[model samples]
Target: MTGYERYLPILLLVGSNIFMTFAWYGHLKYRSAPILTVIVVSWGIAFFEYILMVPANRIGATVYSAPQLKGMQEVITLLVFAGFSTWYLDQPLKWNHWAGFALIIVAAWLIFLE
Candidate 1:
């Protein structure tokens, strides 16, 4: 695969994670909204998440194993979530959270090892 094709999954994953993060956590800003309304709205956002996620997996599978794809996705999710939580939610991550995220990155590195 060309470099662009090889990295397509990562790009798609970034987009997917952005949507997923909002779908799963964006409602915190509107806590006063009705639960049913948030649920429906979250589902609507998640539809776009799946739209990017499914193709990322399908294309990535050609170059990466399922486990590698999952590991990549998890790492991407954490990175995206951290940014969202800090900037959007106004929540700072604690030291332990950074440490835990570092450990997950190590685990992701291990997944790439042959």
Candidate 2:
């Protein structure tokens, strides 16, 4: 595979995670909005997430194992959520959160081991 092809899955994953994170958590900013309204909006956002995520997995499967894809996705999710929580939600991450995330990184490393 070319360099771009090899990295396409990761790029797609990052895009999907951005949409997914916003779909899952962006509604927090509108807490006073009607629950039904937020739910519908979240679903709309999630539709785009699925669009990217499904193709990402399909493309990634050609190069990476299933477990490796899952591990990468989880790590990406955590990283995206961490930034979203901090910048968008104004929630500060504590030391324990960092420690927990570090453990997950270790798990990802193990998953990619030959």
Top of the candidates by TM-score = 1
Return the TM-score for each candidate structure. Answer: 0.97, 0.96
Model 2 C-alpha RMSD vs. true structure (Å) is: 0.9
Candidate number of the best lDDT: 1
Q: What is the Cα-based lDDT of residue 63 in candidate 1?
A: 91
User: Per-residue alpha-carbon lDDT of model 2 for 1-114, expressed as tens digits?
Assistant: 876657899999999999999999999988999999999999999999999999999989988999999999999999999999999999979999999999999999999999
Give lDDT tens digits, candidate 1, residues 20-112. 999999999999999999999999999999999999999999999999999999999999999999999999899999999999999998999
Question: Which residue pairs come into collision in candidate 1?
Answer: none
| Candidate 2 colliding pairs | none
TM-score of 1: 0.97
Clashes of 2: 0
Task: Mark the regions of model 1 whose C-alpha exceeds 4 Å error after superposition.
Answer: none
lDDT score of model 2? 0.94
lDDT of 1: 0.96
**Clash count, predicted structure 1:** 0
Local distance difference test scores for all models: 0.96, 0.94
